[model samples]
Target: MNLFKYWKKDVPASLVVFFVALPLCLGIALASGAPLFSGVIAGIIGGVVVGLISKSNIGVSGPAAGLTAIVLTAITDLGGYEIFLVSVVMAGILQIIMGLLKAGVIGYYFPSSVIKGMLCAIGIIILLKQIPLVLGLSGEMESDRITFINFHEKISIGVIIVSVVSLLVLLLWDEVLAKRSNLFKLVPGPLIAVAIGIIIYLTMGQSGDLALNQSQLVNVPIPEDFNSFISNFTFPNFSALNNPAVYLTALTIAVVASLETLLSVEATDKLDPMKRQTPTSFELIAQGIGNTLSGLIGGLPLTQVIVRSSANVMSGGLSKLSTVLHGLLLLLSVIIIPKLLNLIPLAVLASVLLIIGYKLANPKRFVEMYKLGKEQFIPFIVTVVAIVIFDLLVGIIAGLIVGVIVLLLKSYTNSHSMLIKEFEGKKNLYHMNLAEEVTFVNRGSIVKELDALPQGAFLELDFRKTKILDYDILEYLDEFKVKAKNNNIQIKIISERGIVDDPHSFREFFGHKVFKMGH
Candidate 1:
């Protein structure tokens, strides 16, 4: 049997993600000060290079939203696109070193709530930035320069009206159309909205009498020859290596990009239908290799982008082949029809992204997070607020710090000053007054106490009225059994369940017939 028989199942999803990837590649390149073709190059590399090496089942890597701010700053500070490429190359080397040092474990340290917060915040930011584009108000600057200042131009009332109407249409499609009409589900609503927007733009562009602002039109460079296409590629200046500022920029990019990649990988794994988790170490290695190649080829650094990954999963991607094919399409599209690609209207692409952004940062997300309990909710809200105020990395660090502090406080509150009390010269006569529910977070203190027991000692774990034992804590108890055996100590577990030497397998060790509770 073929190990990857599932590859065939991913065709539909791959096609959808490919369309999603296309506009994002171009738009992000526009957002960065890089050439438009360079964004396409990064997408091609991310899909072909990272996708091939990644252990993740559903994630799709490419030019990341997280790096837009960095790219904007680098392009200006370095005074040229070629100079920024050098920083990217150095960042890639740093990622490789981080992977070799086994820093992949860093991903596991982030609380799930905080990760969710980061995703939702990014969604909001993407939508906010796309507003001006949707209104055909992007022409304030030369087609080459993309900056927030471009929004200073007055947006025509007509464009605003059309954008609002388009947004409403999208909302209706997502809610009523998708559920009530069988055809709508099979054909993605975003694609249809894009087609409609393009039709509208074409109709309006033709009216010679209409006052059209320069910013409303999409500007795609038409490459005439093979030489022009090749010339589009940029190379880095390694001479920038000696600059302390370059090193700082490189470190910032490496750390933020790595964190974002890890977070995306974790989220994508959860969306896998088979619930298979990606290996963090393997993921880091793939990212390192992808970033190194991307930088070398005059492309942007990449991460496992959630937008692409979500599209992949929703479209029915079942294997990495889909991602690889998507990359191939990206590379082929720019090379074969650079002129044809320019026909796409910026407004149409804006509509598609607006829908995606809404899904990610929906108010329902907050409601869901709040329902997960205070432990999950507080950190989730904190992360969202911090990210909105600061950027991605600083917000995540702040969230993590708060999470740790919360964890420590919980530990202190639950920890009994006297975990165990003993009866002198009495065998199997020890007492432990634990809080109502025992968790593995308390395992450290409990294990330390257990380790100090004298040889030939009989242990008693008192849990006469304890309501529950967390699975993690129960696993720790299982390990303690082996430790007790090595020290010639007998453990007596006293619970409502009854007295037994082994709590985990007590019923089996004594008699399965005697225990009637859930396993």
Candidate 2:
């Protein structure tokens, strides 16, 4: 817990995370159909508040892109952005409740396939959303509808040139320059890319036709004075607190934001070089507080974003201080140098996002998932496709459903393996070896296997390897035991503890251990 032990590494890491997070905060707020400044506010709160509260060392919290669709719809449904802030507050309260209830355990239920799919889908969405910006095909920052069909019509040659050069510089810095020097390693590629992009913009501005307009660049509002700057911060309209629609929006935002946060927590922990474990419930509480504060002021809902967390880890952030420092930088930049931030072109930010998107949805990931077999690949692909076609929540639900189906299918197939042994001068032996875990999904298969046993045969039920047997399956076994007795089939159950001879009650046999089974 020595925050300054790694300040040398943490300072540079925080700067890297700040550069990566700034554009994202703005972009996500734009996508959410909220005030652009609100995103920056959320970024600041997420870094300073959540980072200070959360136990995670490397996980960085901020305005999440996953909730953009929900936020956009909620704003429209709630009638105004101010009213939607009420929901954001409610969501934060709900998240705090969830944390206290230890509902963060739900994070463990998500299958790896579904998680992978969610990441891939988000990656694809990022790429799609940035295409218009990168190509300067559209002036609108938040539109996710941009596709190749209309891309050709809105292409700006100057913007395209800037984007290409920025991307190349990023690639060169990341792939080549970083390897050659510690200075390059400390200076993130995105920062370098952004600098190059601004230089290109300034250079190209000398040419009348090649000059980029205000719409094509970052549109951070520059206040004429201190009072005007302070006026940009918005407060929630508490008058909408009684509205049922407001509550509904709150529930949706809380659930979606919590889910995204949990997923990012899991992903970030996996990426940690120290393999540190982040307390899930504590993380939720931190997020809850962060979101509540964000809504009270003028900021979007926040979550532990994978993109930011990954950048933090890659940048060698060793503690939450890096996250807090990044927030401080964001706050200072907006207050002291908003005009300089406004100079950044949208195309440059788009290029940086495109790189992140590529990393997330890399073709190699698809190939690797495919290699994991059909069970993993199907859900992963389904989630990716569903997210692309519908939205983040819908795609994840679709993927989870598919993942559950695959799990059931696996349980059905691997429930038990039957082996018939022919012993000299002995009754025919029917051996059934149960799997490590047997659930209700394996009931039908187990029933069929027991029914297929021949009359006067010796049934050897091996449960030594079985860690769990569902009550439904055990109940079915109890009935099957009676039927086997009538058919003159002798039953011998072998468990990890010992052998069970003609057990009257399977429930009694399982005893106190059954309570801990699913848990």
lDDT (Cα atoms) of all candidates against the true structure: 0.72, 0.84
Model 2 RMSD vs true structure: 3.7
Q: Which ranges in model 2 have alpha carbons more than 4 Å from their true place?
A: 139-154, 206-209, 424-428, 453-458, 463-471, 478-519
TM-score of each: 0.72, 0.86
113-222 in candidate 2: lDDT tens per residue? 88888777767876887877777775454432223435556578889899999989988987899888878877777777878888989999755767787878876677
Worst 10 residues of 1 by lDDT: 139-148
Q: lDDT of model 1 at residue 363?
A: 94
Output the number of the lDDT-best candidate.
Answer: 2
Q: What is the per-residue lDDT of model 1 for residues 408-504, given as tens digits with 9 covering 90 to 100? A: 7688457443433456756544456666666657777777777777787777776664555566566666677887788887777776667776455
All candidates: CA RMSD (Å): 9.5, 3.7
The number of the candidate with the highest TM-score is 2
Superposed model 1: Cα runs more than 4 Å off: 1-12, 72-80, 135-153, 157-187, 206-214, 238-249, 314-316, 417-519
